[model samples]
Target: MPRLADIDEISSLVLFVASDDAGYSTGVEFVADGGNLLGPVPAAKS
Candidate 1:
């Protein structure tokens, strides 16, 4: 499982999103949930 992301990690995204470098970034859909959309993993049977 992926570990929790640091504040800096998220802050970096915010910074970039706010910067002019991302001026062309329209309708951006950022997903920083460590791949939560992949759904839960199944448990292994012993």
Candidate 2:
């Protein structure tokens, strides 16, 4: 149900998205978990 990304991952993505390195980047959605949205499962075992 990963609603949030770890600091490192977010930092990396943010850097790239904001950098000239990602000049062509667009419509980036780091949807932490759409699977849970579709399934909507809580208390399911990992």
- Which is the leading candidate under TM-score? 1
Q: How well is each residue in 1-46 modelled by candidate 1, as lDDT tens digits?
A: 4579889989999999999999898798988887778988789999
Relative to the true structure, candidate 1 reaches a TM of 0.70
Per-residue error for 16 in candidate 2, Å, reads: 0.3
User: What are the per-residue Cα lDDT tens digits for candidate 2 across 1-46?
Assistant: 5576578876887787788987766776655443666775668588
Q: lDDT of each prediction vs. the true structure? A: 0.87, 0.69
Off by over 4 Å in 2: 1-3, 27-46
Q: Which one is best on lDDT?
A: 1
- RMSD of each candidate? 2.6, 4.2
For candidate 2, the TM-score is 0.47
